[model samples]
Target: MKPLADRIALVTGASRGIGRAIAVRLAQDGALVGIHYRAERDKAEQTLDDIRAAGGDGFLIAADLADPAGATQLSEALIAELRARRDPPQFDILVNNAGIDDRKTIEQVTEADFDRMLQINFKSPFFLIQKLLPVIADGGRIINISSMASRLSFPTMPVYAPTKAALSTLSRVLAAHLGPRGITVNAVLPGATSTDLNPLSDPARAAAVRDSVALGRIAGPEDIAPVVAFLASKEGGWITGETIEASGGQRL
Candidate 1:
């Protein structure tokens, strides 16, 4: 399973949820995972520590993708940091998984919410990928964390879904542009996963949501991690510009 052994992977939003799971899974798969977090230093370190406990190599990086300056600094710092490592990591994998959720009614949706969603989820990935594209090895992989909401639209999810859609679009274009260089780009659309955002400890809402899924359970980040690892590996080298849904049969 060391398909990615010696590979260096940078996963944004590695502090928790699906992103954290992806980071740990990639580490287990033998990649030197770079754990990225915005402000959750404690959580990020925990991810790195878990990798160490498992005998895998890892390092922690702090990056605020929500701000343009921070995104630029984060990208540059990663390149600089990886360059300083022993083998000077070429960063074969880039998982653009960092994002934010804005829950608001149609009328309640303000300009600020829209701006923040696009900034972190859409714009940040756009620029970060551009900056990191050169460093990604030929035939490398890029997986963008999108949402099932991109296709399953709802009233309060207008802005969020649009952001995911834009990200998917970006993934497709990058796949085409980078394909000549042998890079693969794709998106993963997840359903209602058991994340901090879901307040799973709250039985009422949790029950209601679980009942909605055909699996009768909400997915955990663990449920989504292996697929990401597979896509990042040579096994998924053939898949590019694809949107693989990791939902637990929740609705459509």
Candidate 2:
């Protein structure tokens, strides 16, 4: 049987990029996926189709994580769907992959911009866990998608990294708090990945990032998804409260 057979997974921001890859990977491992998207319903439908093509079952959910009401809407929709299936309204895996980033320096960053990033990147995940804890199955996995920026001190872009740092810290705390319930909370940090959010369009910049990595290449979404899939499996039960970097040995 597959590692996550008979399990249910919900991946936020699953319309594209790393979130989409993780959703597909979890589905491939035999989990019924809830593909959550904010505005890209078409892309989300495509993801669901891909899951079905891979012989997995999945559906789409819409929620703008930046908004508090969106979180409630998603939870209610998820509960209703689970009930329709005659299964308990419980999820076996929750991948907090939805986030936003700002490439602004301290001087350039405005309060609104900072709040927006924090809302989507940090606050959303915080409340998501608060609201979903009861529905999350015991022994379930809570995987937060973090970034290497939390560790690397880039010259500018100050605001984005701290939000990720907050998420990593949250993961550790949740891991400790939820351990008694058999829930494992962890974070995955990816570096210089080839995603829409972090494009490699500039040849010079791309080559510089590539040279910094031991693997000598930018990681694709495919490279990061399997690590998350592993974390959601039985083998990763003992691993919690850790931030695992799947960064192709970048900045090591």
Candidate 3:
């Protein structure tokens, strides 16, 4: 559709699954995408390949988003990398789709687990956005990948749920702060999707989760990618400061 023509987008954790899908979608929508990955260099290249095969322009980036330094890398230095490809250019869209989910609850949650979850899911995105704020041009779009856990209290995901909630709240505040500059900040809350992060890898556990969804199935990466691309496009220009859940009607 070329709706995002001439726009530039940077997506973190764009190695596989949801991040990979979003990278392809953004490129398909006409934005030159910078696909970011941590150690999944091959997967990132695959994502870039898909974009190229689809007649879209895309580039690849690698960074450990879980690292504290990674946050600053994505926020500031990545801009230089992107600009190196095109002069007088700045990113118009940012998708904070990078995160780690802690399946452990309070009883099982270790100090290290909680720290890692908080660092990647909440802390990194928070600081990264702040660092990149100056480089984001006017009317930019910032999309954070939150989880439906933010809207519901949980048993096995105490730490993870709170992390998403904090991000949701951050979006509310950032929306107002960025509004004056014509930028919109928002969050996407997904219920349950089929990705590598699945703790229930066993057949029985997977079946249970699938049956619980209203769609009678778990979602794939494709299911979530389009929504992200839409939000970053002109169509989503009016949507901001809110968490939009797209989880096949899970009974949270």
Query: Evaluated with TM-score, which candidate comes out highest?
Result: 2
* Candidate with the greatest lDDT versus the true structure: 2
Candidate 2 residue-wise lDDT, 1-252, digit = tens: 999998999999999999999999999999999999999899999999988998998989998888867778888888887887646678899999998877877999899998889889998888888888988999999999999999999867588899999999999999999999999999999888888878898999999999999989999999999999999999999999999999999989
Error of 2 at 80 (Å): 1.4
* Candidate 1 residue spans exceeding 4 A from truth: 86-89
**How high is each candidate's TM-score?**
0.95, 0.98, 0.94
TM-score winner between candidates 2 and 3: 2
Q: What is each predicted model's overall lDDT from 0 to 1?
A: 0.88, 0.92, 0.86
Model 3 accuracy (lDDT, Cα): 0.86
| lDDT (Cα, tens digit) per residue for candidate 3, span 1-252 | 599998999998888889988999999999999898888789899999999999998887777877889887766557777568666657899999888875776889888898888999999899989888878889999999999888887788888889899999999999999999989999998878878765457888788878878888888888998888888988899988989998888874
Over 20-80, each residue of candidate 1 has an lDDT whose tens digit, in order, gives 8999999999999888898879999988888889889888888788887767877888888
Specify the poorest-scoring 10-residue window by lDDT in model 2. Answer: 80-89
